[model samples]
Target: MKKTKVKVKRLKKGSNIAVISPSNGLASVFPHIYEMGLKNLSEVFGFNMVEYPTSRMLSKDLYTNPKLRAEDIQRAFQDESIDGIICTIGGYESVRILEYLDMDIIMNHPKFIMGFSDATTFLSYFNKWGLVTFYGPSVMAGLAQMKNMDQSYEKHLKDMLLKNNKSYVYKPYKQYTNGYKDWSDPELVGQCEAFYDNENGFEFYLDDEPSEGELWGGCIEVLEFIKGTKYWPEPDFWYNKVLFFETSEEKPSPMAVGYMLRNYGIQGILNSIKGLLIARPKDYTEEEKEDLKKIVMDIMTLEFNVKDIPVVFNMDFGHTDPKLILPLGCVVRIKPKENCIELVESPYTNKNK
Candidate 1:
């Protein structure tokens, strides 16, 4: 039998959250946006925020000190005062810090650690070793702009992090923004750009049957960084996994995204996974999205012949406004006919446990 995945206690009001910068030190550069996010965590979520040493370091300084970044994560888990951990923002080349992480410390004291984009490196790695990790908004990106978006965004974050729900059903946001406004401009610090209606919540391509699997995956571009590294999951890890993927703000072309999918097909991953959850590609035009959908279907159906697994597209996660918090290692059920995706297992252990 497979070893049981370890889960950490859920966060509550007044919980002390450790903020760290394992990726780029965007906190120092965009203090206005970062501070707004921290403010929301305090006033809105009722959490006490604790900043780590690397959370406000300069970008150049942080880039030169990947060891320091990894050390921050190590110390956060080791510190008894910290109830949970959240990232300042995502940045490129977080893979550099992976070498410095001590998994013994992280897995032993697994608590909530959430971030998306470049943070995928450590989040996915931690989950691979049986510790549940979160893939969601960071301080500068999603959290800062929470108040500007729909109120449901705040509720979703709280439900995932604070509440102990037996089963949670995910609903698509009525509207979403591709990205945020200029972070440097103090006037638009916490504001997002033009919003678009989410006409189709989730597009189901191969939903002939329902399936359940442990949720795994992150930004598709970030996953590419650890493809052949030890951080990459073993070949057997693909079995019964619902792999979720999305693009970054960099916005690779449809053909480019298809190339990445083709790689998974080549690895025989498409043949083993129970379901596939794809997020809306950031900043893609409507025409581009249709093209992406076609290419994805062609690759999975024609080339890989993966017919049984349920495939969904345009999910509300990754580099998008009002994102959902997806817990890696949690088991989720995908029902195609019902147009539903539900988290059947609680990702958190009781606080006293």
Candidate 2:
């Protein structure tokens, strides 16, 4: 796919932000945290909250129906009152909804769409439409962090959603909240342990010297499952692109990561990209994190032969707290020698009246 520049629009205060669930309907089951997320958006972020038909609907059978899930997303984008769209939470089966979405509607609006985990499916779709979408923090997860949202996480979100800065330096937080609180007890709402971080910053490697390219890719597992599907781009689409991906709580085995990378190599996907951003590994234990990192790096070097490819590890933009919102279709600069990564465009584009 040829690179096309789409200017992102800066949203003003008081604009209505639409919150919808395109994946699992967790909002219906966990109304406490869901409502808490709404409160933060209205009272803290100062945006009017809007909900869709299935925004808070709960059904054991709905999980198996991908059509209904896709309808909710279509309705949200068609509503002109909505200035932006956010997912309520992430879950499996989001990939199933890909066939039901109206790409024309989403591309026409070109509004800000944000989510991670399963949300990566929609993000990739939006990218194919030539629109930039966000991959980071969900409504109930990051925005509704108990006690309060992480200061750094909130800051990065505000910067991307409201401002137009071309460069943002990611900072790892010393502590993070996983949103593990007693839902039955209202008093336990805002309680969580602060995750400690001792790392200084991301480590980058430049393969063909400094290079810039359009950002692509998402959660590694999600991409693999949809690899052969129509939703995934062709081999040439990934050529010379900047690939960014992170793992989820399932804690995929190191062998699994290598297999996926090897598949990309076989498909000629690995050699086509300008850079790669592999986020910090999430596992059951700290030792597992270390083991996964070593395995991933070795695969990149040996199997993929992307030795000079600038790869940055431990960036806070995945399942971890205090995550940074990454623009999927935006131009990203990767300087491996300097150990720096910067976003060069806004994700939102103005709709001409």
User: lDDT, candidate 2, residue 267?
Assistant: 85
Model 2 per-residue lDDT tens digits across residues 228-307? 87877866677668888888878788778767877887888778887878877654366765666677677778766777
Worst 10 residues of 1 by lDDT: 1-10
Q: In candidate 2, residue 281 scores what lDDT?
A: 65
- Model 1, global lDDT: 0.91
Model 1 ranges off by over 4 Å? 1-3, 351-353
lDDT of 1 by residue, 13-106 (tens): 9999999999898889889999999999999989999999998999999999999999999999999989999999999999999999998998
TM-score for candidate 2, residues paired by index: 0.91
Most TM-score-accurate candidate? 1
Superposed by TM-score, candidate 1 places the C-alpha of residue 240 at a distance from the truth, in angstroms, of 0.3
What's model 2's lDDT at 209?
Answer: 67
When summed lDDT is taken over every stretch of 10 residues in candidate 2, the lowest stretch is 1-10
